[model samples]
Every structure is written in structure tokens, then in C-alpha cells.
Target: MIFELQNDYIELFKLIKVLDLVDSGGDAKKLVVEGLVKRNGEIELKKRAKIVSGDVIEIAEVRIEVKG
Candidate 1:
């Protein structure tokens, strides 16, 4: 899926929550802390990692592409 960024960037956890990938922000944070989320191709442990355009985030079987 593709997420169109309205600002310069969006927090990783917020992105997940905004996309409805999880039930809430806390769930999204848990996913990140547990190493279930990836930025580009590496495991992203930062719940508030800045997600900007051209970045790809993966969680479970879902792939979200950020676009400016």
C-alpha cells in the first residue's frame, strides 16, 4: 500500500496507526519495539522514526510505501 505524506514526515508508530495496521498507537509501538517493523530492509526499533518519502515500511505481510 502507498501512504501519501501530508507533512515532511510521519512517525513510524503513527504511520502504522494511521494506516489502521494496528488497533492503536500503543499496539504500533509494541510492534516496533518487538522488532516486527522494518524500515527499508532493516529492523526499525524506533517507534518515532521519521518516515519520509521514498521509504518502505514492512510489518508482517504488509508493505507500506511512503510518498511525498
Candidate 2:
């Protein structure tokens, strides 16, 4: 699943909120804590980690590619 990234850049938590991937900031943190999300194949544990253009976010069986 591809999600469009705004401004080709986004702060981590803001992106999570904007994507609707999680219900809220708390949920976002949960997902990260559970190791349900990956950034470039590494476990992303920080819900506030910045996500920039060209970053690949893998969640479960879905892939959200970041583009400018």
C-alpha cells in the first residue's frame, strides 16, 4: 500500500497522525513498541523519528513508499 507523503518531508509523529495508520499518537507508539513497523528494514521503535522523502515504511504486509 502506497501512502502519499506531504511536502516530501514530515516529522515522525505528525506523519503517523496524517497517514491514519494508527488511531492516535498513543497507538502509534504501541505499534512501534511491538515492532510492527520498520524503516528500511530496521525495527522503528521511535514514534517520533523523522521520515523524509525516499524512506520506505514497512508495516506488516504493507509497504508505504515515501516520495517527493
**Tens-digit lDDT track for model 2 on 5-39?**
66757766566667787789887778877888889
Instruction: Give the candidate number with the greatest lDDT.
Output: 1
Q: Please list all clashing residue pairs in model 2, or write none if there are none.
A: none
At residue 43, give the lDDT of candidate 2.
Answer: 90
What is the model-wide C-alpha lDDT for candidate 1? 0.97
Model 2, residue 47: distance off in Å is: 1.3
Off by over 4 Å in 1: none
Task: Pick out the ten consecutive residues of candidate 1 with the lowest summed lDDT.
Answer: 19-28
Maximum-TM-score candidate: 1
List TM-scores for all candidates, in order: 0.98, 0.77
